[model samples]
Target: MSLFAGMAMDEESVKAGKLQIANYKLGENVHLFGGAFYLCYQKGLINWLTDWNPDVLIMEANPRYIATPSAVKWMHARGRKVIGWGLGAPPSNSPHFLQKWGKRQRGVFLSQFDALISYSQRGADEYAALGFPREKIFVAHNSVAPAPTFQVSRPKFHEKPSIIFVGRLQARKRVNWLIRACAEMGSKPRLVIVGDGPEREKLELLANEIYPATEFVGAKHGAELTPYFAEADLFVLPGTGGLAVQEAMAHGLPVIVAKGDGTQDDLVRAGNGWQIPPEDYGALVQVTREALSDASRVGRMGEESLRIVTEEINIEKMVASFVRALNSLRY
Candidate 1:
């Protein structure tokens, strides 16, 4: 069972086999006493497991949620295979005490599972480093569906360049860094900001003050996001979570992203995109300048990006990898 039953399932996944999804009635997440708390009813859990009679169970490895651990133990007791999927590494530069404690706790908790699936190769390596058996660790790289094809021709370098950012406008996203970097450019590109959050007004105010060419297009999805990808010369996400990086590359746009979560390590490469040190404004600015300096280089990098997504990291490959991992546990 999964927490996000309404999540979009690709046609490839549907055709792979019969699939069932379930969701917990998520309760309000409260933060107090220096920790987070939330509620999930276990009322129907036993019944659901009984009815489904699943051969394997996959769950997120967030230890904060008591329900997951309880469910894991329940399923294991019944002789069913259980898998914990997660970002295997702690947050970069996490507190020493928290890191040490978390490592110990996760080692104990995750050891109960039949196998552990990491979101990236880096994550799998981390699981191994923590003493999890290497053979039991699997990498099912995160991916997104390819964007709809846009018929537009590539923009020339001298033509007005478009630099786009697509994600939640939150503090951790550090979108303000993109705005500040745009301000430093000699020839400013048209900056398109997609998705909205609490930081919208603040970001809008900063954009108006320094980078007037900035356009805030609000949140977009599916085909609605195609044009932004089609019109852009480059894509930038100065914070974490890079599912958008894969989508942009599928649309033939090269990327610039911050280094943090290992997601970028799997998606971004030398020819396809560049990874900036997290929160390093100077390095961000310098890389942006050099990348935009040559228009032809941008076009070439975009081609490379498309090739990588099409051949190496598209949803088809991701689904195939998942199917192989799941089948391996069946026997």
Candidate 2:
């Protein structure tokens, strides 16, 4: 069969290192609910069952989605390969089910599908730790966008200090610590938070109360992020795993990324940015202070951010990995 190669499998993409584009789609959604699908399981199952016309059905990774035995069986009956993407490894709930399955049973269960895609080696490791063999589990990261071509050359940086945080204000994100860190500094640096979330009001209140210098610009996307990345002296994320790190780096902003964010475990390097020990709020504060102090280091590291993404983490590599994994599927 002819492949979907234009936008999906563009030749330019191959040059960028995209291994594969999904030729067939399936009964799954990834974004909503962190890997959840619509309700009405019985009706949804029937809808997916009758409409089964693809080779690969990527099941949503949440417990509700994978636990559907009938859903698994229906796709199998249709002569299709079922794969799971959008799965986070170490903390994934899949092993809870697979652990009870025996050695042969475990192999059979994991080996059945076309392939599983995860965001990082750590994520892939999460599955491997679960007894899911490496052959079956694939590390396919989210796409990394290209650096924008500004009409004007990016202006040189000033010695003025800045600290930026990008991500939701969710619990695990640990944004409050950042507000406090800003408070700790006698000559507090400008603490700018870019994303919006449930903690907005409270965090804003805390920032206002503790460190009035904090700037919560609410949520931002697209070109909106550029100014923040450009203006920032140092980028800081107290929480784990952020697309912003990639975005910030693309714009020549160096990062102070939190460790164990699953995705950051792959890219945090002394060459580019500092990996603040995860949950080490005091360390996060101290590191942010130090990062901003070295103006020259920040400039060099910012360039490194761009270099790292260009050389190692571009989107082409991601798409190609997907293609390679899918093509290798035993189906």
Candidate 3:
């Protein structure tokens, strides 16, 4: 099977897997009215498709892209199986027109695919609700490569708790909510922010004024991130994007994530962590205080988080699911 990716995939991923990938050179990344879209152009796509003649073609299902629809129809006409892979359906909070017309258009477009691969079960359900067949939709939980091995010594309840937030500091991320929530925790726990973006300077200013215990670590990757994950007693992302949630869980830290994008539904479970309503600063503060106040529960929850990442959602497991989906198409 061959996969067509709009962005550059890791060399290790291509070498380790049986599936071959063809990367496209992206053109302008148009952003309009708070929505970001990409334009992908592959000059050799048609020739490559003809020469390679892949049994199955898997493409991203982003509505913003123009190529996907045409490519899907082109592949379908040639009797090749096409799979739509992405976070299906826009979030419910999207513009009403998008929810109405956009969803209907997506539903029609997705129904043409032989199968659909969702980032989470919530996404699969959304696709089904939008008229895609339930049986044809597969849940391939989004994940990252396994986190580095680290030993976390459980802290006593009375010990000062360390809370970590890892992601780009952007407006939509609502890092300010986390800063405000941490300040409300009465400076008992140390709050570490481990990423930088447009909101960095402002967030730093807010942290200094409101939460003096907050530490801004700019951005760290690979082994550099190990110490933050290893030392933290709890992980919190009060906004969207929970890829870091899985990474924290893999490092044996329980997460407190906001409900957004439906990706967190698969990763954050009852035993593992809490999922508060989006943008609820009061609830975030209360949850953080309670979780930090009881270290024993946090430790147990951390163990559940570790178990879920190791057993259910990791890079290996995700790739295996993709392989299975591709294999199913052949038979």
Candidate 4:
């Protein structure tokens, strides 16, 4: 498929093998209103659209993208189909009036699309709740590149199990909470923190003060990062983001992730791992202890983790969902 992006490939994303590089790039991405709104423009967009003339156009679901509305109008004029792809609608549980207004605006924007493809079932459900036709909404569970092989055997529980957290050290990640939770444990696991970010220094200081043995391995990707997942008995993401959880499962480690983006609902299930209440310290510690408490059970759970990634969700399934959504539409 021909793809376009607003940014060039970065060393980190390329090395991590996460993002698929675009065939062409648009103008520099502009963020307005303190980065809440995103807009990208390209003088060549119309030229590309005319030359390619795709039967279907799948655009970002975010209403804030300044070019999307015009693009949608362009496609509709040609009687071509358009699909809205995104994480989900605005937070359904948010009590803020602004969020409610945002959700309404999203609904109005998304109503223009011929079909919707969400990253998770939770997202699909949200779209339906927003009055999008349920039949038109498809779920493509978010994924990472699967491991070359699922050879990492289930880890045996030890006096101190190895717990790995892979992702940027950002405030929203809540790595500090992970440290505090481990510190309170009677038998703390060996915490290996992979990745570096703005919060790395503050996190390192917090780790030293409480969980002194926590390892900060800077950032490793591709082959360098695999060993960390292979060696760890468990993977924990205390804050938002679930991409690393998919990688951990592919390597046969049961995960413990806080309720983050709605994707967690699909990734962390009863069979594969635990999804603790977000920002709940007591829940994190309790779940970690229980997961590590049984060596054999952990192994079985790891196997389940592998099964989920292989049989249920991956890049292959994600692509298939896109194809299915396109096939279901009349173009």
Q: lDDT (CA) for every model shown?
A: 0.77, 0.66, 0.78, 0.81
Q: Candidate 4, 304: how far from true, in Å? A: 1.1
lDDT of candidate 4? 0.81
Q: All candidates' TM-scores?
A: 0.84, 0.75, 0.84, 0.87
Better of 2 and 3 by lDDT: 3
RMSD of each: 5.5, 7.8, 4.8, 3.4
Best by lDDT: 4
Give the 10-residue window scoring lowest on summed lDDT in candidate 2.
2-11
If both were scored by TM-score, which would come out higher, candidate 2 or candidate 4? 4
- Winner of 1 and 2 under lDDT: 1
- The TM-score of predicted model 1 comes to 0.84
Rank order by lDDT, top first? 4, 3, 1, 2
TM-score of 3: 0.84
Deviating ranges (above 4 Å) for candidate 2: 1-43, 61-64, 86-88, 91-109, 129-133, 144-157
1-331 per-residue lDDT for model 3 (tens digits)? 3433433333212222233454433333233343344444544456557666776788777666656667777798888898889886855566898678767787777777888899988889889999888878888888877633555555543257788999877777788998888777764688899997778999988988988779998888767898888778899999876568888898888999999878888889889999999868888889888887777888899988988888888888788878878877887
Looking at model 1, residue 284 earns an lDDT score of 87
Number of backbone collisions per candidate: 0, 10, 0, 0
Better of 2 and 3 by TM-score: 3
Instruction: Give candidate 3 regions above 4 Å deviation.
Output: 1-53, 90-104, 147-153
What does the lDDT read for residue 85 in candidate 4?
95
Tens-digit lDDT string for candidate 2 (1-331): 1121112122111222334653332233222232233332323444644554556666544344434456567678877776666545344244665545533453455555556788788777766766676787777666557534443234445545777888767666788988898788765677888987677888988877888888888888788787777778777778765677777777777888788737776666787788877868889877877776777787888877777777667687687777877787654
